[model samples]
Every structure is written in C-alpha cells, then in structure tokens.
Target: MTASTVLYEPSKDGITTITINRPAVRNAVNHATSLKLAEAFQKFENDASQKVCIFTGAGTNFCAGYDLHEVAGNSTGEVAVGPVDKVNGAFGPMGPSRMQLSKPIIAAISGHAVAGGLELSLLADMRVVDTTAVFGVFCRRFGVPLIDGGTVRLPKVVGQGRALDMILTGRPVDAQEALAFGLANRVVPKGQAVEAARALARDLLGFPQKCMQADLVSAHYSAYDSPSLEDALRFEFARGALVVAEESVQGAKKFDKGAGRGGKFEKGKL
Candidate 1:
C-alpha cells in the first residue's frame, strides 16, 4: 500500500516472484520501494531452494519509469543521501537489477518498460515480453539520463549502434522489434508474459543447478582473448570440478542403476 513496498513471493515451484506493486504509478521505484527490492533480492540470492526468479509488475503496465513526482522533489544532488552521493543518478539502492542474482531470472513484461523500467527488464537472464509490450529509452524525451545499467547493458544486449539509435531518437519499440534485436528472449500473448516466464522457470528447475551456474558464470565472463578466456575457463573448472567430484559421480551411478535420467527419460515425457 505504501510507496516503499514491493511485492515478494516464493512460488510453488521454487520460483521466487518479485513484483513491483506500485501500479498506481506504474511501479515507479521510490526510496522505500528500492529498499524493499534490495531486500527481496537478498532473500532470493541466499535461498538455495529457489532455482529461478520471476520479476513482474502487478498490473497491465510493467513499469512506467521513475516516479517523476518523487524525483522532482529530491534536492539531494548537492548533498549526500542513501548509498549514493547524488540523487539524479539511477535508482541505485532501489533497483532489483543493479544486484546480480546467480540463479536464473525471467522477466514477465506486460506493457511498457520505459526508461528505468526498461533498464529493470534488461537485468533478467531471460525475458518474456507481452506481444503488445512497448519498450523505449523514454527518459531522453524528458531530458532524463540513464544512469542505471541500461547504458552499459543495452549495448551488450542489442548492439551499440541500436542502443545509440534508441537513446538518441527516443523511439518506442514494439515486442517484435525487441525480439529481433535480442532484447527479449520470448514474446508471448498479452497478459500471458508472467505465465510464460513462470512455466520456463519451472522447466529450468529440472536441470542440475551446479552445471547451470558453472555454465552461466563461464559464458558471462569468458572473452575471445586468450588470457580472459583462460581465466574464465579456469573459474568454470574450479566451480565445475566440485560438481564433477561427487554429485555428477553419484548421478552417473544412478543412471547406470536405472534411476538416472538417461535411462528413464523417454522421448519427451518429462
């Protein structure tokens, strides 16, 4: 009910759900909301029981952007406040995306994810945007800058040239364009985004967490250059070696004993 609270839930399939509940203002990140989001993410990060997370808005609109009403009132640029020295920068302490979650997260976007909202969506490992979803670097129109991870992540997700086009032109892109540009992993029917994300999360749980984490870490950190590539591989091996040490050994025994996935897992019944 208050501006500071965001919604948090652990779903039936060990899919933690973090919902932006301030739909009246399209889930704008206020100071309180930011704190709550950080807290919720903390829980997700620590819970080994949860294999995935789903972030979504409570209503039709995913997020309209920053609560300009709240932003307008801040005079803290001259003074230090909450975690950061300035106020106009991205919603630092208040964003679910600024912090990285090791477990996979799927974003379910229903409507518009503009400016900060779009930045938030970009945080997820995979995103299921509604076919009618609208994405934009909307803050440019109002002279607001993207101080969040958007400036950094957008170019990585989409190309730098495309990112520049959005930032410079402030164009609203439909879900199709977002899909084409690799901004979203999947586009679903409107109002079905959350459902699709949830289903994917459920499916993801079938995989071994250790392997998933090892692969994710390697893929994210690896580079084409020899040194960085070698370091990434070393990290991956260090992490993966533990799984291979015992867990995978036991898993192999199980399959050999007929309890393993390979033997019982028929064509596609799972």
Candidate 2:
C-alpha cells in the first residue's frame, strides 16, 4: 500500500493492464487512488500504440468498492468526486467510470466487485470473471448511491427487473448468476480471469483495427447516444462506411486468399 495504489503495465503487443493494487482493503478506491486510476486510463486512451486494456484488481479481489473509511472521514467540506466534463469525458469517484474509451477494455474479475466496484466493471466492454467473482450493489445497504454508470449501465447489461433486483436488494450475484444475467461475458476457472482477458485481448488485436474500433464506437453510440432506430442505423452506417475503404477492402482480399475460409481463423491475417 506504500507504493502506488494503482499500477499500469503496458505490453509490447498493444495491451495495457491497469491494476487496482490496494488489496489490503480489497482494492478499494480512495480519492488519491481514484485520481491515479483516472490518469492511468487517460494515458491508455491517449496512447495510440495501446490497442486494448485489461482492468483488474491485485491479489484476491477485483474491488470491494470505494473505501468507506475515506467517505466517513470527509471533513474537508470538498466533494470527494473527480472532475466532470461530459462533452469530452469524465471520471467518477471510482475513477475512469465515466470515460468513453475509444479502445476496448476487458474487466478481469476474480473476487468481489460490489457497489462502486460493480460500477467500475460496467465501464468495460467485456468482463472475464472467475468462479470466485461476485457482483452486487452493496452500496445500497450503506445508503450510498450508484453515482458511477452503474444505474444506467446495469439496466442495459441486464434487464431492468434484474438490475433492480440487485440494486434494491443488495444481494451478491455469483459468477454463474452474473453470466446468466449477461453481467459477465465469460466465466473462467478461479484465478484465471486476467489470463483469459489477456487472451481475449490478443484475439481482438488480430482483427483489423479500424473496423473493430468503428464497430465498437458505433455499438456504443447506438446503445447510449442514438435518439431513435433511424439515428442509430445512420450512425452505424456512417461510421462503418468510413472503415470499409480503410479495412474491409483488405479484409475481403484476405478472405479471397482463404485466410479465414470455412470459419478457420488465421491470426493477424485479417
């Protein structure tokens, strides 16, 4: 805990792994740690060489949520929240929770991801959770609100009823239940979440970058920004069309060369 509470490690293959290192407190996020986490994610966003990000917590847990100790000792009269500028992006008290990252992020969940931690995981495009992973709105029990994207994202990830069940009841959802609820994209063996997320990131890296990013952006826009079905389709088509000439043409040529024939994938070929 003496060292940085957040750690950032970048691999040569365009994978940046951001870790919450406060395992002593179940990797809880405090004001300082939240700022550090936001900075790390902003660094990843600014680095064009970093294609994907894997977010996890060190030791046994993903994150227990925001440090209640810090919240209880807030005598400075200043709001314990990160800066917010919705036009560009914003950071929540949990840090990076409000960021609209261009690159894909995979949440590697192992232990408890409750309250704010659950909100943090919702920021990721995908979650690779281990058997021990748990998701909940534990903050409900403490009368804490989900100021992060939890309230918005949770309903989108799972249905409104399911999200409400967890939100109102403050019950823990195990990995299996989370997967069934669409909260977890993949469930792996205990202790293998990070590796699985890294492997998934490698698979994503093998694809045409522009096309993948365009698709990702389009999907996000449709999910959260589009006004209607027509607007969503228009945005998707516009963005996807931009990448067609840039990546799809080459991908088509690769396909013609049988690189991905019969559903057989050749890494990095297309």
Candidate 3:
C-alpha cells in the first residue's frame, strides 16, 4: 500500500476506497490532488486483486471543485522554478468530474455536491447520497459550467427535460429528489454513505466479472442509438457471446450443484 496524500485504501475484497483530502477548502481539487488521484487510480487498475473503486470526500462536502484561488493566482514566489507550463492535466484525469473509468466506481456523497462538486459526483458508476445531501448544477450561476460529465451524462442518467431543468436553472436538488431523478441509486443517513457504498461494492463483487463487463459495455452502447435495431441487437449479441463462454459454463455447473436461480452467485473474487 503506497502512501498518498489523497487517501487510497482498499479492502481485502478488492474494493479500493479513495477519499479526497482537501477538506480545508471543501476538498477542492488542485494540481497535486489530481496527480494523487491519477496515481491511485492507476495503481488500483494494475493491482488485478482489486475490482471496484469507491470515491468519496472527507468532511462536510464531497468536493467544491477546483481550487479557484490557486487558479486565480499568478505568482509562485521566488523559487525560480522556470516558466509555468500552460499544459493542463499535469495531474491525471482522475480528479473530480473527470473521465470514464474502466472499472465500476461508486461515489459516496454526503453534505453538499454543488458546481464542480456535483459534476464530480456524477463520475461514479453508482452514487449513494446522504439523506441530507444536496446536489446542484450551481456553476451556471457562477459561470463555471459543468465541464466534466454533467452536460453529457446527466441527461442519460436522469431524463433530458429534468437535466435541462437543473442545468438551465442551476437549482439544488435534495437526496429524495435526486433519487426520484435517478441521479443517486440510494440515500442513507448523513455520514453513512460510505458504508452503504461499500456494501453495494461487496454485492457487486459477487457478480460475474466477464458477464458484468459485457453487460456494462452493452449498456453503454445502448446509450448511443445505432443505425438500425438489428445493428444494436448484433452488438449486444457479440457482447453476450463473449460472456457466455465464461459465466455461462459456470452457471450451468452451478445449476448442476443445486445453486440455481435466486441462490448465491459464486464469486471467484479475483
């Protein structure tokens, strides 16, 4: 377990937990923070022992977005550290409101998830918001638009009209409303979102890996309307065929061993 400023702790069962550490600034992401995130994500990906990743922030907020003060500042003192490179993403893309992660990532959000914070929460494959949690696309009012996955993923997770309502108005939605909108999978008491997320990850660990990935791929592909229904079906068939070779064979054996429908799914737990 490598030491990291941005806490990255994994359980024995392959669930890597990542907690944003800058609580002093509402866990606002900065250059150093992004690097830590990237390193943690890459490590988890390479471990092979890990399967799922859970992301959360320490303290009263999940993430307040980027460090605005740092972004606004122009000076770096008298260290004589050469020119400031304009190339962004010096830190990896694993920061708040970032890119698509290959493995399923769960977010446990408590307190406020506003602006880029809310956008960051959207990165997770599944989100469990605290009952007191608040979500807002508030950056519209501040002129900082959801630069991450907001404009794109939000509409798909919720409905287009609902997403537009939030984006256009920059209104805050509570946990119950988020659940109704499908933005969050579950809602729990404040400070318990992480526990809930862990339980969900444990459940996911029981599911077949190849089957889940194939299903995940098909679901992602389903989001894009194909040229024809047949084309879409063909894509699903191909994904399904790949999984059938692995999980299907084991599934048959499970049935033979009296572990059929509704019984506990065997987990190789790699």
Candidate 4:
C-alpha cells in the first residue's frame, strides 16, 4: 500500500540489495509497488559506487507475479500500459524489467517466481535459487501473457526449445531442474539464496570493475542487440579495447607479479 513495500539496502562494500516486501500477496508487484521497484533500481544504477545488486523478495517467496487483484478491480478491464521508448528504455508493467542495467544484478530466489515474477528474475544477470524456489509461467492459466520480457529473455537464457516447453506447458520448474535448464546459476540450501548471492556479489566486486563491466555490456549486446557474429565481435573488441588501457594493464601487472598465482583470488588485492 505504501512505497516502503519495496525496500533498498546498500552495503558499504558496494552491494545493493533491493527487496520486494509485500509478502502478504507473496510479494506480487502491484502498480505502486512496481513504481517503487523501478525507482529503487534507478537509484542503484545512478550510484557509481554501487557495483552489484541483489534482487529478492521478503518472507518466503520471490514474487507471485503482477497483482491480479489490481487487474480484477480495473473498471476498464485493462491494465495500464506505459509508453515505450526503445532508445532510453521505459518502465514495464512489472517495473524495471525493461531496463538494461550497466552493472549486473543477481536474483536471489526462494519461493515462487512465476509469470511476471519469472520475467523479473530473467532481468538479472544470474539467479541464486534456494531449494524452495519454483519457476513457472503460472499466469498462463489466467490468460495473462508474458508482457514483461519473458518471451524475449527466457529463450536467450535457457535456449529456445526449453523456453518453448516452459512457455507452452506452464509447468512449474523447481530449483534443481532449473539448474539443469540453466535458469538457476546456483542452487543452495533453503533460506540461503540471499546469502549466496551476496557472497557471489562480493566475488564480482573483487574483479577489475571496468573490464568486468565492459565484458558484461558486450555480452548483453551480442545476445540481444548485435546484427551478426561479426558485428558482435567488433562491438566486443571495441568495448574491451577501451577497458584494456584502463584496467587490463594493471591486471596484467598483478598477474605477472604472481598476485593471482595458482588461480587464487586475493580478494581486495585484485
């Protein structure tokens, strides 16, 4: 009911954790909650010091989906749709699903991540799922379409054939199965998704930031924006070359000095 339904927690070590707090409805994002989520993520994006984001929901669940109760109450029988501007990006019905984040965000999943919830999880660079986590296109039973990048990103993440199986059947995919499908990057014991994600975020922070971000952006472009393999290669080289002078030189020096010998990461030293 209030903006506080979405909570933002920024750590001193540069990990920002954004939580959906409406556990009453299993953390479903209503219109107001969606706006709050968008605002919170925008804040994270704007803070240069914040390097990674951990996205999760409060209580037992990740998210059920967009609040259908809100849809049920709409007098016009239509949910409000935001205007889209592909260049600058725009808010989707599920808040920041349309955003192309400069830095990586990890989804720390517990319970259901279905329908719009599943789409939201797809927004992250990777997902850390607990044993209790469940993923599905649950809105299909109600004729609700996957409007928040589900149809687009899901295939890219898990392959088109696998994506079609989930999209068409609307069957629930549990954490272990999700790992095999390449949906969940890591599966931990129940209630440890957030902690695992935070640990992974810290690992990311230990890397050379410019080079990591450059590679991340290049990967995203190759997956969604590039016209062809050659174009993707050109884009990657250009972006990576910019980072070479800025970070790779220093990283190479560290490597040469045996700072990262035997494939061991020295945390902050890196």
Q: Higher-lDDT candidate among 3 and 4? A: 4
lDDT digits (tens) for residues 14-87 of candidate 1: 88999999877878777667667767877898988877889989888888776777766776531112534333
- lDDT by residue (1-270, candidate 3, tens digit) is 643459989878889999888788888776677666766776876787888999898887888775666555635421111112222533222243444555788999988787767777877789998987888876686565555567877898898999999999988899999999999899999889999998889888887877886777676667645677788889899989987977988878877877755555444232
* lDDT of candidates 1 onward, in order: 0.76, 0.90, 0.75, 0.91
Lowest lDDT 10-mer window, candidate 4? 80-89
Candidate 2 at 164: error in angstroms?
Answer: 0.8
Model 1 TM-score, all chains together:
0.85
- Which 10-residue window in model 1 sums to the lowest lDDT? 77-86
**lDDT, residue 150, model 4:** 95
TM-score of each candidate structure, all chains considered together: 0.85, 0.94, 0.83, 0.94
Candidate 1 overall Cα lDDT vs. reference? 0.76
Superposition error at 86 for model 4 (Å): 13
Model 3: number of backbone collisions: 1
Return the lDDT, model 4, position 219.
96
- How many residue pairs clash in all the candidates, one count each? 3, 0, 1, 0
The Cα error of candidate 1 at residue 217, in Å, is 2.5
